[model samples]
Target: MPSTDSSEAPNEASTDASTAPWDVHRLPRADGKTFLVTGGNAGIGYFVAEQLAATGATVVLGSRDADKADAAAASIRSRVPDARVRQIRLDLADLASLKASAEALRTDRLDAVVHNAGVKFDQPPRRETGDGHEAMFGINHLGHFALTHWLAPLLAAAPEGRVVTTGSFAATSERLDLDDLESSQDYRPDRTYGRSKLAQMLFGFELDRRLRAAGNTVRSVVTHPGGALDSLTPPRPPLHAPTTGERLRGLPAGILVQGKEAAAWSAVRAVLDPSVSGGQLWAPRIFGLRGTPRLRPVRGHLADAEVAARLWSASRDLTGVEPEFGLG
Candidate 1:
């Protein structure tokens, strides 16, 4: 495991999922603030909830499959006796699902929204969601975009709230497909996934800029797991049993960051560390492109201010949901 000494967590303290960084010994409030994590059944998302629930926060799993969600909640409660886990069915590929899930939230004060769910198809195929957006692009980027839009009110109501999105090293290589938002021209397995990740990073930075410009106090933060180091990477192994394929490629990420521990750090820091500013990209420190969660700068042509703005505008047009929260 990476040394906890280097974390920029509150008070420069070590960070564990269950305990706040030295800065925040108390897990955030469980009283009224609510948290929702996408793809919370297994891997990092599950661990995020585990830590949050263990510390006394209410969490809802945004899952596409109800059964998997139920299992996730039961599993968490088994581990953390005071877990407040709820399930909401959401399909990132479906716009209606995004809207429905957003409306399903009964709590008004949404302390945080984590977009951790993602997919990387191993084969090359021209796929689009029912909404006509590219499969990888739609689900990975647009789906979360829409969900964030719907939940803006929940975020705005909080005295101090945040929105965290997960991106990857693949994003540094991805160029904005402004001419073709849906990746219609050509499709390669890994590159297409990279394109989606790139879009995700752009969205995070752009969201922060928009929020700042609109005068909303809500903090917008973006974090990424090292390339192929994240828990939700391809060739997903069984619940407890990891396979040979993942082990070989992810040796660095695994060695640097074990299981959910690796993916959770940057995200946990982004939320708990108040010194962190908006539009900053956080990854691991050493060989971060492959392991641990550390704050690192990623420079790319696609992340150009002009391109980010263009992508944000296009996302609004595509989702038919204007950027209302931070665009005051």
Candidate 2:
């Protein structure tokens, strides 16, 4: 394994921080590294996988749809013919399937695990997943929580392992209800989604603290893809382009929302940038809407230790996937 550990300094010479917030072109070669990206079939996840693969890293795209995964892999290959990439079946909405996918992963030398899969739209008629939790919360927070717990040992095995969880601006105004994470008593789609994102933020920061306390090298980082417009995603042949109406809608969004490719920069930076340490939050430098990605301060409730501890405990109890190394 590589000798890189938490003590090693970042390859600062490779990426000039003064020139830009993050430049994928300046990323150091990841010839022997491996990364896993959930929901890599489309949107920002696909772009993240593509960027990692472009850096000569072995990227494992995780998605529920086998066909879409294959297409995504093929699309990456078409862009970077020599890109090393593969796919695995991972349904974050389904606990059993998610566990099975984690068990099937080749975790002996994983460098980073990017949790990017999520349900953005508020699916009305709030429903619970197979694990008996709210669908959005289950898929967005609980599912990734379980997967990360299961894969913690593997991440620890790597010299500079990282777990990158995608957060959202919505978390800024939302409060996670630990006593009722599933929103059992009351369920509003938007608030439920906001609470779920906040949960993810809490988990990422809490996990980093736990890893540090336990003297582990693994890093848990949180990032947000600011207003990534889906219409601007890379076109995969045979896949229809944005409709006329969608294009028209994208016109205004184009000004406010960054393309999926650019939006992926935050997550990619969190995982690959050696300067980025555990518990750091990275997001857009603009109005939390679109612009260059940069490291941001964790403020207000985001830095609340009591809430984070409660979330960590509640996650372990709910998922039943106790981390092998992160628990202190």
Candidate 3:
């Protein structure tokens, strides 16, 4: 099992063999690899997809909106002239549609999958998914859970497959109520959102444990984009066009927080860095809010085996999809 030590040092191999820090602008070549970035049409996800595409890998943008996905793909192609990008319609809110989405990949092996898509409501009027679970928890946690189950075989076929789950800083202060996984009883928008992300992070950590026990080469890595602000983000035309006023107002916050592009570094690094091991948590270097990506010790409830195991069981029961690891 991976270490749970809070004081553990960052992995020395996190840097390249030349002892130089990992540079996001110049990623190592991944010509033959295929990566999927959920919600790649906008925000940090778009930047993650763009960065990965720069390495000559085929990137699949998983989004419910076809037009947006097309536009995002176009943007990537324009930026990286040789980029190879595809799109697959994925509606996480509807459980029945995911198997088809997984099948749409049209490839036998998937190198890595970045679970960056999520839903967060800012106001009242509690919502539920098509499956009758809370929207936030259902889409953010359960949807990915089921999708992973269907994609297991394709992942296992890879030489060294990876499942990179994008977690959140909001999850750090929250705890999961496994008894009320869906928050059907007491539902506050912010709290529910936090709990949903917390559940996802828990699932990521627990998944690494199960992968190890199953003797699977596929690794599960978790990452969080801390304090990403749209105003701080660079415009991606129709997807994200921040006004000058918005950029001016966001400058002060940029000192501690960062734009979506910077936020993409953690997940991108987690996906591409050869030294990043399963069970490690990658985040920004400066107080985890902004800076270059680096390894952060897995601590607190994230390292709680008992809670993670319970959450894993609850997730399996709720989704009714058992991830097939092939052996143990």
All candidates: TM-score = 0.84, 0.90, 0.96
The per-prediction CA RMSD against the true structure, in angstroms, equals 4.9, 5.6, 2.6
User: What TM-score does prediction 3 earn?
Assistant: 0.96
Clashing residue pairs in candidate 2, if any? none
lDDT: worst 10-residue window of model 2: 1-10
Return the clash pairs for model 1, or none: 10-23, 283-294, 284-294
The lDDT of each candidate is 0.73, 0.82, 0.89
Query: Candidate 3's error at 101, in angstroms?
Result: 0.6
Ranking by TM-score: 3, 2, 1
List, residue by residue over 1-328, the lDDT tens digit for candidate 1.
Answer: 1234543444233434554433223444455557888888776777666666765678889998888888788878887787888978888999877777987878877888888888888896788889998899899999998889888888888876788888876776567668887778877768889888888888888888888887788887788765433432433223334566655766655554444544566676666555556677776665554444455544556358898888888988899885478475
State model 2's lDDT: 0.82
By lDDT, the best candidate is: 3
Two-way lDDT contest, 2 vs 3, winner: 3
Candidate 2 lDDT tens digits, 1-328 = 0122333224322255564435666776789898999999888898899889988999999999999999889989989879999998998877667667876776587899999999865567888888788888889998999888667777888999999999988888899887788889888999999999999999899888888888889988999888877676555565436776776677777777777888898898888877788888878766666766666767789999899989878877888775657464
Give model 1's TM-score versus the native structure: 0.84
Model 3, residue 77: C-alpha shift (Å): 1.0
- Model 3 C-alpha RMSD to native: 2.6
Candidate that would win on TM-score: 3
